[model samples]
Target: MDFFRIDLSFWLQLQFSARVALRLPAAPRSLRERTFLVPNPILGVFLHWLGGLASGSFYVPYRRVKHWAWETYWLVGGFFSWIIAPWLLALLLTRDLFAVLRE
Candidate 1:
């Protein structure tokens, strides 16, 4: 209903969709299959740009939190951005996530 909830929901959905998409099986070997397996340089660049934009803008939401001390706001934001979101995303995206982490 609110912006935080909406944003969180959107992020969760997007991550889940990405994980599902990435899990699709590759087609058997062929010219087209080889082409598909090759990472597109343009798409790679675009993804990096998008990630930079997202990281740069991550603190924008904190600006709307009035009456909060800077440290309080920053710590709260940092916990979500650095800890919670990454953990949740990794759990969603990876098979044997705990095994990978343990290694």
Candidate 2:
């Protein structure tokens, strides 16, 4: 069975009670497979998305540019990605960006 399907089943069983018995599939066998099992898959997925957004902007240049030389485009894009994007997002998302940054 799919890993996420198994996780969803577990989550729903917990939510509605064991009376909603699913034929829980055999647990993953190997250590690597077992490593993905979480007590709460919803929080796990949301945290993964939050991590992705925190590390975003890597693909900005690749998507928007086709003509500029490698170093030129990357320098410009990296400047915006590393320097401008975080501050811009912080300002837009927070009520007290400057105070938060002071820490």
Candidate 3:
């Protein structure tokens, strides 16, 4: 397959995964819950869209990189972006970064 298809597939998977997490009873609550203890579907949707765009945009840079095996570059970049970046970001955003992974 092509890069766009691969990137979009990963993005959709992440979106679906995040949706499942938000449905959990102990989802760090939400940005809404942190301050007001109320859920906001609007904010959730916006955040989802923002994440989608950010992921797609980050993948764009890989499109310009050439002369390397697709499998090689894709795996390396995907490992850093999907795994490493998320782990660090989760640590910064939530104190319980390992909670969801443990579930």
Question: TM-scores of all models?
Answer: 0.49, 0.40, 0.45
lDDT per residue, candidate 2, 1-65, as tens digits? 35533433223233346566655455445522343444678888999998898568565547657
Q: Residue 102's C-alpha lDDT in candidate 2? A: 91
- The window of 10 residues in a row where model 2 has the poorest summed lDDT is 5-14
Per lDDT, the best of the predicted structures is: 1
lDDT per prediction? 0.67, 0.65, 0.62
Sliding window of 10 residues with minimal summed lDDT for model 3: 4-13
Off by over 4 Å in 2: 1-40, 43-65
Off by over 4 Å in 3: 1-37, 94-103
Q: Write the per-residue lDDT of candidate 3 for residues 72-98, one digit (tens) a residue.
A: 787988899889987888889986767
RMSD of each: 15.7, 13.0, 15.4
Alpha-carbon shift of residue 77 in model 2 (angstroms): 1.8
Model 2 error, position 34 (Å): 31
Compared with the true structure, model 1 gives a TM-score of 0.49
